[model samples]
Target: MESSSHQDSVDSTPVSYESSQHSQLSPSYPRAQTTSLSLSSTPVNDQAHNGYSSPATSVSPQPEEPFKAPSPAVTRKKLSGYVGFANLPNQVHRKSVRKGFQFTAMVVGESGLGKSTLINTLFSTTIKPQRLYSQPGSELPSTVSVESTSADIEENGVRLRLTVVDTPGFGDYVNNDESWKPIVDNIEARFDAYLEQENRVNRQKMVDNRVHACLYFLQPTGHSLKPIDIEFMRRLHQKVNLIPIIAKSDTMTDEEILVFKQRVLRDINYHQIQIFSAPIYDNEDEETLGENEAIASKIPFAVVGSTSLVQSAITGQEIRGRSYPWGVVEVDNEDHCDFVKLRQMLIRTHMEDLRERTNLVLYERYRTEKLLGMGVAQDPTVFKEINPAAKMAEERTLHEAKLSKMEAEMKMVFQQKVQEKEAKLKQSEEELYARHKEMKDALEKQRLELEEKKRRVESGRPLTPDRPSVGQQQSQKKRFGLGK
Candidate 1:
């Protein structure tokens, strides 16, 4: 009985061990199998002998399953929480503010057109000092001279480097035929300087002294553009952003200004001069579109520039304008002048646009022409942006055309070879046919001669010619009477 009980216990131990091993091999029963193996390794009699509780009684029957890995095909997911990446505009704004900005503007017109005053009024600061003419007896300058003034201004912690280029003695001469030459030369010189800097090895500290915008102040003649104005603009329009302004517009009535603007525009159109206008974009809001339109409607802006403060009679407010006996012309008043609109477009709205156009359009054109003059040629496709799909299609088309050309050449060669072979074969066939016909005719003539010989033999005729040769010849000679 004791041996049988021992045998039964041994058999039960192997069964439990095998079950634990099987459970350990299965993925879903890892933890439960580990616990069962640990508990089963201890003997039950040893636990009772040591007065210790069996660990199997405390073990759980089932254990939680392990986590499975996600599927490889799963890509998109609905995020339950936020992850921040929406501050790009703020970052750009901060960087731009840290870098600051720079702008260069050129003012071109005749003397006493209030160019200096207009620049001062635009920036709300004294940019160019008032120029004092020489005494009445002193000689004036023979030609136009370019004057440049620079200032660093700051508004709300944003710093700006502003440069104003003034052209003096432009139309003051009686023979102002070459007045635009000096200004044009100066602008080209700036472009050359920039190109030189670009060609240098180290361009880190390059200065941008290129003139971006040119404000051409038109005289309030209540007529059309002057000859000098037309010539100057025609020369400089391609090099700079041309902004036309009517100086001292307060002198002309609103009706006169309107008619004068029309005449000036007509002249500009007739001369094929390009003036700077605000660019309209499709994505702009309605307000921006309307604002741009309003600004454009006031082109060739008629303006009155005054730095003096005058109290308005109606508003009882001090405004930057000139006081007159009859009425005051406010510089910031839109109804009185287009000074505010001009300032808005120049400084507030289209400042960057002006710089961009100058660099991209005007400067690039000049650079291209200069390089071409210097014998430096460039491929038209260089630095040009191309769409990948279009490029692929173009390559495919070229490949197809090339294949077609090769196929055509191959077909032409094959046809020529075939024709030559046919001609050779025909010649050989004709030669064989002619040789066979000649052999056949020889055989037929031989047969005819044999048949005649056989027929003569059958009829007992002489086989050889009855030429008793010498005797027959002598007899014939005698009969002919002189052969001897």
Candidate 2:
């Protein structure tokens, strides 16, 4: 039964079961018949002579296909529960409030411009140190002196570190040629301080002492910006945000102030002086934009600064203003003066903006110039993550421009060289022609002389007159030799 099963398995393909059984049972069998009768299902193995081959007759490996990345899904996910991340702004607000804020302002003007009083009224804090009034004959300060006052004011759980820098005796000297130097030096010193602190290895206790805004108090002369004012603004405009103010506005009449403001604005525009204008952002609402515009329109603010409160006769209420024989000039009243707008800009509206501009724009510009002057080089493409395509486009345009410039320069050089070579060749050709003409003239002269000589010889004519022979001369001279 086992042998029959084996025969059946062996002869599954070709040989019959009877032939397989006969071959297996026979002790001696013909090799050809046995080999021909045997049926195998396994593949045949062939031996190769020289090269590598598989044990099987016909086999080849198929190349594996490269792997491909799966495409990302472009579907929006729906939240199953509230993540509570909408409170990020509130979180930022709380953190900012807790950290508090610091702002430094600089007041630059002549003496008696009410700079200190304006500062006090703006922040509603006594940051300026009280100074005693000098007698009529007191000697004036020889030079401008810088004074600083600082205070910590808190209101509604918000703390503010306010600093006020005052410049006294500015424009007070008879010869104020370089009067703005001290102020400029002070501002630069503050910048240096901040830069030094930044360059330090440890910066935990870095203090920002740089000035943010400069309040330039112009004298209320009912005219235009004085030489000192113009020069000072020109020197310091790029350093700090300038806020020009018309001090002692009560002294000027309404029409006079209006004309003066126009004149001042014209002068500023003509000189290309930049003043601190309120920035209107894209996200601002109409009301805010309107307010900003209003504030901006009131530049060179004609202001009356008074830290005292007085009762208004018209309204019969307590207000911050100056009482005079004619009427009360309200400080906070927009109709009376622009103190309210100035205060609003200095403290209420754009205090943070002032600081931000000082730190970001002015300081960064100064830092860049300073670093470059110090032989420091920086790659301009370090922080270009925002709008990479636009940056690339800009760079490509610049590169093309550079390449075009180089090509133009090379073409010009090549043209110049060609022209020089042509000029040299022309000059050499003229020289060669002159030389050839000279040689030809010389050769013609020689040929003419030789031809004349040949003609003289061919004509059988003596080249010179015939002369007597020595023997004939002696024989002929024998007759005449007795005399000599």
Candidate 3:
């Protein structure tokens, strides 16, 4: 019976099932026949030669059809879910690329949102002790401004110099002040020089626009655009990429953050920036990035957040509380916070843009200064206060190093004066936009009233006056200008 069963298994396709002792025991045995028959159903064993031979003798009948694999369900899962692979094959070029894209930035934000704090922390040094202002009603200056400070720190074998610009809070002073202007004017002036490009840049880049980037800081308060912040941005919009940063994010709730983002999207016309909160570091981006991280990180976080390779330092296995205690705090609703997100965004997405911008700025500086040689054209003025040789080499562009410094000086001296002017200017603009809106609303209302009056008049009733138009006063003002 077994022999018959084996015969049935081999069928037209003969599968040879062998055992070392098969010839001794069972060449003729029924069990041997059964084994031969069932050979087709068994998995193929790897042969000594390791390759399979064609089943020309037809050892096994093919299953009714080849095994059909299960179909994968479509879902929203992103490739990022895969670790390591999510990043990319060994970032072999990345290490060198990271070396290539070290960036530096100096940006300012609305005061009190911890811009300065972030800068100091990133650098792991005290930039300038933030002057604690005696609460209002006290005699102390609302803020003792942190003297501008910058330094070079080595991290993970990379040397980066960071200059943190701790700008005093704008638009928040309680008293009537005119201090914002000259500083703004100076910034506008420096920016204007870059924009005007009468000089200071290559002809190719000298197109009407200016400045490689301008990162605007927005606090975690509400999304309502402050008149002053909007004013500042509008002035620089034509010149720089307006990056709006969200500071002190730890203070904001998730809902608030969403509302803020939506509000900014609706209110501000520029592209929604890499909006980030505190504790968020610039992360590395791959696809659109040109390898390295952004130069702006070398500059200041208040100015820009993540750049390509410039990862934020989270508390890692090697890091301890004394080193990065703050990393313990929650951010963006996650217990395990990753500041690197912000860093990666800036570094990867904007890295090339940053490097190109920096190099261009350097070249422009060199050409515009028109120095014949370090020996001949070197300005002694830059070196007087330091080791002359070192200072000379360090600050050949000393004049430009004072770019924001010059602006700040103007602020220090004329803060009150500028504040007064800004107020007037602000009032004028508000009056203008508001006046136009009012006129538009009034014109529509008046036309409707006129129709009503005409309807009543057509019916033979009396027409009443549509009241004084807003322009009645403006007409008076124009007459004043005419008198002038």
Candidate 4:
């Protein structure tokens, strides 16, 4: 019996193992399949085929259940390796360097204000040719002419495509009422061109011809801004970044330059004109912030531009400046003028910022207005992002609306049910009243008839006229069968 029991246990082990395996492999199969697998499978078939009998001591049932493979959709896989995307800034810098950059600056001033000399000296190269002093009796231009000059300049392997737009004879004419018209028109034309390019179906090659910065040269006179200068700045302040500079500052004394800068800034503020101020970023270090502040403090920069290299009498060193009867005025000298600060802000620091502002703020405002004027509307929700608080508020409003509607419907249904029940109750009450009245009338009639019969009997009157009297019973009996 012991051997038999052990043998039965060993034989059943493989059957149970196979059934469990099948169940784990296919958990979706019906229970009948599991029962059949356990009942039909036999380990004896394998033992007979191999001509081997199971050793009782070696046979044992599994102690653990079968493992089920998880569903593919819910299974999570761990990453085995790392991919590098931290070099994105390097990639963008490389791409920008390869593509090069373009910047267009507009210069507006009257003739003989050293606009050409300033441009040549600012770039440290001959961008504009040096002009000779106008000879007497020479004809002056009657109208302002828009002229552009471009140069590809490189420094330390970095290339810059600089374009300077010079407005000749801006304030030279006597009738300068509409002097700012051409400049405004040119700026608008550039904006229109950019807008047209954006609306095109294929924009593979986009040329940025828009003016990023406008350098307005104020004459170095000790007085305030002229009417033409005020009008020009007013017209173009919203359209471009305005940077005011006191041109030919060498002619003005130190005290005159200081007082002139104050008066110019005061007039600008009074007229509500916006000048380009260096933007301070939150992430900038203290040193950088200080540098930017120093640059901005020298607004309406007092600049003296000179392309000629002259020997300084004090240091005997050659510098780009002009010779005066008193002494040499070095162009790069901070004590002499603010040319270093101007160059630093215009080229070294804020070039890209100027471009960014022109494209994002100034151009965007113009584009929005233009599109609206053309009767094109934009959906306000297009620029909105999904915020959890706002979304929850909106969802709560909708849910409240739904709940209020449901409550109103329920109230209406309950009222209708109550009205119907009231009507039915009223009808049943009326029917019961009518039935009670009819029964009362019948009972009253029966009582009246009984009273009349009692009255007749008491008064000794016959109840019916055809019936015999009670005293004539003998005559009645003789006349009927009662006599027999």
Candidate 5:
């Protein structure tokens, strides 16, 4: 069985880590994405595989004083780019609680699926999105995936100091998205430093200061949670608190909405997930349609207009605008709802319960045959078999070794991912160069044609801006009295 601490680390990926919506789905979420101690990717079928995470080294770049600005470092080294999560504070060890809590989250999804737009809309930040492309010839996805974004956001009486994570677009490229294995592989390739054993839990920073919850922003649509979403939620199941949100609920209908709910809940049951969703108001206007030919071509639809219908039923008097019958009054004027209640349920109610469960059931409880997957917290006597001091020392060593190995393995894994990305970027650069060359060549051909016309004009030969067929050219010359 995996250790609890590692589970804790993985769970934190959303709060401090994140995921959300899109129209695409992958056949499987990558094995590397799962929070495990081992880092190697060459796994046999029998051995369990989650996705992979690269190693992370603490970076404390000293900021220059106000008078002096800093220079960005340029290196021809392996690119283990850290997406989603924010940097650890400089004096994190020194606990001086400040004003306003840092509420972090990672945004993930396909390239054009509004992941970045959602972040900008939510936090009101001006984040320039990077273009995501595909790999050449092999028909595979671009190695430079739309990974998690590492950014802070704030808005609307909600000073949510958040980290919007941007992930690689799943089905953006041409590779058969047989459940998008490569996309998940990229997530599994994120930095995995907390789960390392020898790595002493920065109990303060990690346990108390890590991610509080994960908000999975699903795009509003008629389609339900695709297999890819199921795989994603399943993998991140134990790692963090998940709040499933519908981004654009306007496109769904009464029947489709019911199906989407039933399907998601069914998947939740199948996974045996206890701590689950608290519904939030649909943030986007469902009526807003996409302009892209690919998206605009789909059937135009509207959200179920029951707001007024429900409102009339409630007040004994005829009401106008949106309403519902289930007493699901979205009290906050067309805009806000009781997210406070939902927030409490997410960050408070089930929090301590899950925390305890994670530590007791998932963490302290060992399941290596000795306990046979039973709860290990039942008896205190289990600790008696080994010497207290020696056991502590051994545990520390093992933990350290686990940490070191995890570091080395994660570093290697993410580096491979980075190299894959760099190679992709290099290829894209080459393609762009070729495209520029082609455009230049075409422009030259057009230029030569114009030059020939100018030369004819100077020599008193028949000339015109447009090229004409033989019959038309002769007719024009005859009309102009130019046929000698």
Candidate 6:
């Protein structure tokens, strides 16, 4: 009676009333259609309610939609105020300044070509001191050797680590056939060092020892390039940045220097030897473009280097140049020679460009060849970019193909099972039919015998006359004494 009364009270309460009560308790919460709310006035009685029936109410949950990723199209946004990210250049500048910079330069030429003087003049420092020749009757070095010098220089809070590689005794031998081999081997050795560092597990302290520029000093002979010059440039051009310089240009007149530069360029072009030139960009300003163009126009620069300052012939002002009886030739004067242009391109403007070209072009080419020679290959798709949509589509296609194959296999198995079942049922039906026919034939034969016996009884004929019984045959044998 108590259970009946409790069920009656529950049925009297409407769902709307319960939902209103829940909303009054928690008004901000949203009520979903599939949500169930139950209220019990007392404890559940397990004995009163059958175990099959639950006391709580439950609602089936609706299936939710699958999540989709956002589109990959880039969206540009405009900011109203200056953000700190705009100062990224300043941050990088501070970091780079704090870390400092490093650069390596190589100079290759024969002895007494003023290579040491030119290097000292270029950097405005005694990086390579003047070498003292051996005394008379001393034996000379039979082979060329490479020498390197390093210095740390700082100016206005910025520091630079400069390395200069010098090739002495080059082109000094009587048979200078293999003079360039040592220089080439040294450059390759630097490249190998850098490659080894890159392959190391800890690369945070990796150093860049690769050659960035090669300054090949040319003899001021007032003629075309020699076979040795052409051969050296041709062999070393691919390995490093080649900057051909006409050494000791004060020895030749202006007309002769001009004619010699043309002839040297002709020979270089004829031999297809590449030389480093300043690169111009489309977005550069007019001043920069003009400056780069002027720099490029003075390729194969004719230069003179001197540490001592001399007075100018016209201005009477002290300048860096050579003192001559006829007139003073200023090293910093564009009218005198191409020294100022060479310095501008090499140090003031294109130093970073040289480093970039070496790392991205020259070093990369050498590394590729080295790796290929060592049988190291890279997959073409290793660093390839992937599109999310395209990748998803490809995966979906593969999944659909797999599903199709599985479905075909299932259908084939089902058909085979159905065929086997049909064959078994057909065999069973044939066997049942044969058993029924045999039973019918036996029943018909029994019915005919019964009719014949009834006919024999009605006609009053002796049933025993058709076939004698075994008891009657035994009695006749005993009577005739033939039973034994």
TM-scores, all candidates, are 0.64, 0.63, 0.37, 0.62, 0.36, 0.64
- For all candidates in order, the CA lDDT equals 0.74, 0.72, 0.42, 0.72, 0.41, 0.74
Model 1, span 23-92: residue lDDT tens: 1110000000001111012222212212322222232245355334344595787778786556787788
Q: What lDDT score is found at residue 40 in candidate 6?
A: 22
The 10-residue segment of model 6 with minimum total lDDT is 23-32
**Candidate 5's residue-wise lDDT over 32-122, tens digit each?**
1111111122321221112322122212234354322245587886559865335445344223233333433444444444445434322
lDDT-based ranking: 1, 6, 4, 2, 3, 5
lDDT by residue for model 4 over 131-248, one digit each (tens)?
5557899986667767776677655445566677888778887789888887888888888888988888988777787888899999887666777777889899888889999998
In the predicted model 2, the residue pairs found to clash are none
Question: lDDT value for candidate 6?
Answer: 0.74
How many backbone clashes can be found in candidate 4?
0
Pairs in clash, predicted candidate 1: none
Candidate 4 vs 6: which has more lDDT: 6
**lDDT for predicted candidate 5 compared with the true structure:** 0.41
Q: Which stretches of candidate 2 lie over 4 Å from their true place?
A: 1-81, 136-139, 381-484
Root-mean-square deviation of Cα positions for candidate 4 versus the true structure, in angstroms: 34.7
Q: Candidate 6, residues 274-352: lDDT per residue as tens digits?
A: 6777776668899988997787767789999887789988899887788988888888888888988888888778887
Higher-scoring candidate on lDDT, 2 or 6: 6
lDDT (0-100) at residue 300 of candidate 1? 85
Mark the regions of model 1 whose C-alpha exceeds 4 Å error after superposition: 1-85, 382-484
- Give lDDT tens digits, candidate 3, residues 1-484: 0111211012221122122211111000000000011111233322222131212122232335433445669888657454675456337445643552233344556556656554443333454356476687776445313223444444333333333334454555664254344334433443444434544445453321122344466766544555555566555543333456666555555555555554444334332222221121246356323322232221112222111122236533332112234443332212322233444444324434443543343233443354443344654434223454565666767767788799988888798898899999999999999989999999999999888988998897657656667779678878879533
lDDT of 2 at 284: 82
Model 4 lDDT, residue 375, Cα:
96
- Give the distance in Å from residue 280's predicted Cα in candidate 5 to where it truly belongs: 18
Q: Against the true structure, candidate 4 has what lDDT? A: 0.72
Q: Give a tens-digit lDDT track for model 2, residues 345-374.
A: 777777777877787767877887888899
